[model samples]
Target: MLAACRGFVFDLDGCVWQGEVLSPGAGEVLTALHRAGRRIAFLTNNSRATGPAIRAKLHRLGLAFAEHALTPLEIIGSVVAERFGRSRVLVIGAPELTAAVRAGGHDIVDVAAFRTATVVVVGNDFELTYERLAAAARAAAAGAPLVTPNVDPRLPIEGGDFLPGSGAIVAAVATAAGVRPVVVGKPESPLFRMALRRLGLEPAEAAMVGDSLESDVAGGRAVGMRTVLYAPGAPPAPGAADLVVRSFVELARAAGVG
Candidate 1:
């Protein structure tokens, strides 16, 4: 089922790396696919870091194909610009996300201007506070559009650790504001479409590989792409993905690559 695809899309946090440590056999599988002339795109829902930062980290990790990487950070600007015209934006995310929104010809306003904010963009804010959350909630409650990356509750990290993801933050605002945010990342069509565009392949010609069955698998399936679940531990459910692999080695074998 996996051998027919000419291109592949991978998720970052779990499938490629668990944190600063790269997942075992990930580089080998990617190299084999590249050598076999398969187009690949790295689509991550991680909104904390920009694309360049991720590329630099990939370089440091000695992973090739850094050029094919995309994160919510890189595409957020365009997503915002196209969704909402230039207006006052309240950003409850990292500095990089703020910069992206500003670069989109939107004004980044603080909590003081929440009442007048045209839209509220939410991501993972490390320095989150009740004040910030309340302001963002108020802004959204006041009819400002709310946008976020993905709602993955947990982010996989090294040593089998996890962190609260952007979804956690988005959830807080959503509950308080009583509004479902406009999601631009996984489980949504925008990011998947962007990844396909980058690879220049139709959904039928490529596969989406990631750990999250809800986000990656569902998102890919929504776009009519085959799905591969990189589940290293627990047993996969019946028909969760088109294919399920315990490691990149297994994925390579299944895909009939090197």
Candidate 2:
């Protein structure tokens, strides 16, 4: 049931690898797809890494892909900058998130420098505290637009349990400030649209593959694209995907990629 598509989009981290442990045969699948001359892009909501960084990680894992073949924090940054401008933006995120914002020509402001903020961008911050949360809430309550990178609740780490993602932080800030943030990540966001545009493919001809039902499957399905759920240890939802597999290799097989 996986032999008719022109392009493929993959969600990183879970579907491809988890915390440096490459999913079994993941690289072989990607290698096969490349050999078959199929268009591939690694789509991710990991706002913690830039495209180059993600590319570096993939290279280290023995996967080969062009720099333009990945999208993550860069897209989110563009969205924020386009909507909120480059100056006076308060960010509650990690280095990559902040860097993405800055790369888009925006100024990053700390919570203490809140009075001048026109927007508040939130992502995964390991150093989060009540003070920062309160400051973000105040900024939002003061009429700053709230933008989130993605809503993944947890991220897999090498030897540790899943770490809380930006979603957890977004939930807390929204609850405290009584406002819902505009999320630019997956499952119901324009970020996928951005990817579609970048690939020059209509939504109907593109397919989204990921390991999660929330962002990858749900988000892709919501946008009318064929969706694949790669649940290595989890099962696909009853009716959430067009295809289900244990690895992206199955995705290539289905898409006639190799």
| Top of the candidates by TM-score | 1
- Number of backbone collisions per candidate, in order? 0, 4
In model 2, which range of ten residues has the least summed lDDT?
64-73
**TM per prediction:** 0.96, 0.89
Please report the candidate that would top lDDT against the real structure: 1
lDDT of every model, 2 decimals: 0.88, 0.78
Cα RMSD of all models vs. native, in order, equals 1.3, 2.3
Q: For candidate 1, write residues 128-226 as lDDT tens digits.
A: 999999999999999999998778898899989999999999999999999999988898887889889988999999999999999999999999999
Error of 1 at 249 (Å): 1.3
* Per-residue lDDT value at 89 in model 2: 82
Give the per-residue lDDT of model 2 (tens digit) for 26-66. 78887787677656677788867777788788888887664
Q: Which stretches of candidate 1 lie over 4 Å from their true place?
A: none
